[model samples]
Target: MSLTRLLFTAAASVAVLAAVPAGAHADTGPYRMPPPPFGSPDAPGADRLTVSVVDSGNGNDGTYELECGPAGGSHPDPRAACGRLDELAAAGQDPFAPVPAGTYCTMQYGGSATAHVTGTWHGRSVDASYKLTDGCEISRWNRLTPVLPATAP
Candidate 1:
């Protein structure tokens, strides 16, 4: 091949290689589900609850819904309090990182209650729980509380 033609072909190949998307460059490996929410169940003054997040990889964003109740009673839907996870992801924020470590009030009589969350993640469903202290005021279900590395499973 002529020197000029050879050089042109090499440069074109390099350019095409560079144009590939970064994510495409690497295999994301197997799709591993995120760890479950971490927190103690109930203490002397602590109420326990579960919080699960389903990472729906669907381009439409994810949803976070919660059902809460007392330690041994029927659970009620508290979806309104849990807010939308997809919205947080859109805002570039960790969707589950604001659930405070305390008690929360039930959506009904403003009574104390525990929390159970269910959502979709990477097209999969997730469910977790949380126990709050007595007389806890669940004004609003913030993002999932920060899970300490030591406590994560």
Candidate 2:
């Protein structure tokens, strides 16, 4: 395979691996993977977010209210979504982080689905947009899974 193809494959592999359950350890090498989270994080005041799918092929086109730290709201599955977010946070990964600069993305198209997420997370304000325009974007969307919807490649 060409160097470029190999790099793309590696990046894609990374993306796939990133979709692993949040409770999975991020460490590499000899570190042993631990069991899934058995305890819930203490519920604080209210960390809320609103997810609006501007365009969707599935029934998820409407808006949803998500409340974490206690995991209650209009979101389809607040517990799972909040658990996913908790896992990401514990792994030191920002679920809403943007695609890094200059990162090459595959030309593969995921879909025309568009989403806008707004509210406060981790005590910080958040307003992010999501689109399944390319490979990286799709992976990012999938990373949030049911929080968004596993409707992409």
Candidate 3:
């Protein structure tokens, strides 16, 4: 290539580089964009779920509607359930997230209880199931304690 053309290309590259602020390449910080209101359960479209249990030895088998923010519904303890959900979210954990695939869980059996939760939480869809079949499953069910009745078989 001609020296003049190569020099022109170099100068153009330098100009482009100089146009960007140095801090642009540096790690300014974690996601600067404001995040969803995980702390505010009362926010619209927050917690509105339905929990259903079948064959649960605890005798709490039945579907119950749950609403948060104002905290109302057929749920026995909307306040407590909402509190648990908010707490988990604030801790950077998704209370309704399923156990990861291939994860090892204890073979111990919790019970025959099986529960399903379906609805929207913090503007996200949730369709989680709970069963007392293994340690991980039991823990997942227990984490939502009041949401899902403390079942035993």
Top candidate on TM-score is 3
Candidate 3, which segments miss by more than 4 Å at Cα? 1-44
> Per-prediction TM-score, please?
0.26, 0.68, 0.72
How many residue pairs clash per model?
Answer: 32, 0, 1
lDDT (tens digit, per residue) of candidate 2 on 1-153:
999999999999999998987667766446675533322243233579999885667767789999987899999899999888888878868889889999999999888898888997775677989998998998999898778865633
Q: Model 3's lDDT to the true fold?
A: 0.84
* Residue 49 Cα positional deviation in candidate 2, in Å, after optimal superposition: 0.2
Candidate closer to the true structure by TM-score (higher is better), 1 or 3 = 3
Expressed as tens digits, the lDDT of each residue in 85-144 for candidate 3 is: 878888878888899999999999987788889998887788998888899998888888
User: Tens digit of lDDT per residue, candidate 1, span 26-95?
Assistant: 6666678654333212212222233433221222122322332222212133332222343444455544
Q: After superposition, how far is residue 73 of candidate 1 from its true place, in Å?
A: 23
RMSD of each: 16.2, 20.5, 6.8
Error of 3 at 1 (Å): 25
